[model samples]
Target: GFPGNYTDHTIANAAALLGAGRVVGVHRKAELPNYKVFDEKRYFHPGSRPTVVTVKGFRVGVLICEDIWVPEPVRSARAAGAELLVVINASPYECGKQREREAIARARVTDVGLPMAYVNTVSGQDELVFDGNSFAMDATGEVCMRAPPFVEGLYRVDFVRERGRVVPRSGPVAAELSDEASVYGALVLGVRDYVTKHGFPGVVMGLSGGIDSALTLAIAVDALGPERVHAVMMPSRYTSQMSLDDAADEARQLGVKYSVLSIEDVHRDPRDAGRGVRGAPGGYHGREHPVALPDAAADGLVQQDRTDAADHRQQERDGGRLATLYGDMAGGFAPIKDCSKLLVYRLAAYRNGLGAVIPQRVIDRAPSAELRADQKDSDALPPYEVLDPILAAFIEEDLSVEEIAARGFDRATVGRVLDLVKRNEYKRRQAPPGVRVSRRAFGRDWRYPITNGYRRESR
Candidate 1:
């Protein structure tokens, strides 16, 4: 019992959720993925149970995520007098997986001459985002009801009615949604549930007028509503008037409360703190490693003093690192804290172009952290179009430096980008968990040691 049966625990949990006489059935995952950062094979036993249970006088068969990927579960469910199939899954979010699941599950119903009701969980548990795209199909092989993707709802579908198999008569579900739409759905649902369940009424974001913040703000407004949503433009001197103006505009349009809190004061406070009663700057430095800055200066990159940099880094310097209380200050959670720079831009554009669209001023503004004077995102990061691809290769595909070089990226640029990503692992670790649309995410799917001594060929 030291290791414990996760399968048994899972089954029991389902039973509790459905309650007594509800005929809750738990199907364990028969196949496990255990390579390149996955180790499920080391944990639980392969599922052998595939029987149907009668719930409320309706015969139901339940299967886990991976079980029905093959044909055995469907065949067994039909063989067990199951007229309606209910699948409880914990499938991860890969690019086009929600649509694929719908196709695969619908086919199973048609192939077996039974109805299927699929239920999925959502949220970023480490690396994977379980998009709850629950759906149902009748015995005639027609999809009757589909719960929206990237959300969680306990709505009922008439699997069979009047003992005559009266199917659900809901409106047509949205089909052929864009990939971004699917990704956005997952993020919004995850945000909604996480905030609501955690007892947090709503969320707030530091809207920088960049795609990431815009998307995050939009998603937060969507999930928690404009009333609960809050936006803060923590602009520094380098933050363009364009960005600040656009950010403030989004808050107004959404009807969310907007605040302008300049981080310049905190940046200035730190330098004074270092010289005054706050003790020496080195006093904040204990167990600290110089990972934030590069040794060599190239491409106009220079070590802009960390005194006004990250409060977390400052805490680290003080031998006591702490995350900046941005969320706490605004009294709301951050929705897309872990979203990549490039995806942020694209998502911003997508939101702005939708329905009424975000104003052109927001999209046209340059990206900046607004930490100092004349600071541009290009000063801290490479062009997103260029940077995102390499990040996708390295983070999503797990490609190495040489492999990326073979893809026609400049070797020096690749090394620099890779280094920036690696060095910022600590920051990424501190970031709020975002939606995991890609195969490999910032946290779960991709993990490398932070204190590595290995150098790339360019070095």
Candidate 2:
């Protein structure tokens, strides 16, 4: 097999040693991808052409990641007398990315009349995670063999000459991952590899009693064993006793090193500070809110409001002057920042399903910031049942206000939500990067202009 190279030196040498003919797709010069989630333009040049060769009395073609997605490369190989296509990919895992790959491959196979085998790299790489849902399809555009997602292993397949053409024998087809499962797996792998690859001894995170911190802690403990993870709870005067108890219970159940630090001395009520510190228009204090938590129905909105009223106290004191790395907000990374209010709850429940690490009460309790007394998320925003879907439509689906309102929401509400999403772009831009699990995340996928004046025309 030939790989993309700068010159034919390596390929020629290897072919001479093996005494076999080979085709190589190599960069004549350094090239780079000048688009989303890729900085390749900073690295290597583009290759010459699709590699086609003869192997085991069969003509075969080899293409790289970007090559297979387009039509010309596969067509070129077919013109060169290739009967089979082998595409090597390092495609990153985004929501529904695997489907896109298969669709592209199917189109190629359909056009070229050659059986295609698409192999992708698996495991996590920093902010990106790769899903190895490798598979092969026949010239008729049907999958012949499929490998499981997110796992790494070798799969064997037999090809036989039938009717003067090489045909792939049908084999095992692993079930595609469910939406929640796939996202969760991606997050776990992303955390694990990011921590390990950087050669960190362990990870430390603030385990506030809230859903975002709770889910983050669970992911951390799952990625790196409890021994390698540390959870700390910092309570202020506004912190509720329930939050304290729940935070403590979470640390105990997960079996991680836990510590409680009181920030009451330095904590000031924003109202008292009198700096007009308004609550940021988001869920649970600018943190990822939960999606469909298990006991979400059990703890009704009535309970949520009641609990919020009980927990509400004061605005979170602005920490611009006091922010420090070693203070209340000390951590190398923030895992759940991108999660929505409802998704955070859902992930916590999902993690608990594998084991009872997060206490049931934590999942069942109403979410609060605990930065001030009786401060419920609902105080500043609509209920998550209303907010999450709206956020999804705007942030992920790119729907207009009228379109969102047509989906049974108030026009004013939709308008307000969209405004918040736009106004908060600066905040999101400054926030630390988190795992991307949606079609359009706040990270690389989104590149909106901060000062744009384009308004959604009402229908």
Q: Which candidate number maximizes lDDT?
A: 2
Candidate 2 lDDT, tens digit per residue, 1-459?
A: 233333433321011112145433321211234566776555555655545666677777766667766687778878988899877667888777877888988899989888988888887764578888999899898898999887889998777789998889999988777666777788787778777777766765666686667777777777788887666566656667888888898899889888775544433332234333355523232222111121122123314322110010000101011111222222344455456667767776777778877777777877665434576766667777888788888777878898899999999877776776666565454445556676666767678766767755342
**Clashes in model 1: which pairs?**
284-317, 284-318, 285-317, 315-320, 315-321, 352-357, 352-358
Report how far off residue 324 is in candidate 2 (Å): 13
Q: Estimated TM-score per prediction?
A: 0.71, 0.78
The C-alpha local distance difference test score for the whole of candidate 2 amounts to: 0.64
Q: Per-residue lDDT of 38-76 in model 1, one digit per residue for the tens?
A: 577776666665657767777777666655677777888
Root mean square deviation (Cα) for candidate 1: 8.7
Error of 1 at 36 (Å): 8.4
lDDT of 1 at 427: 56
Query: Which segments of model 2 are wrong by more than 4 Å?
Result: 1-48, 268-330, 451-459
Q: After superposition, how far is residue 237 of candidate 1 from its true place, in Å?
A: 3.4
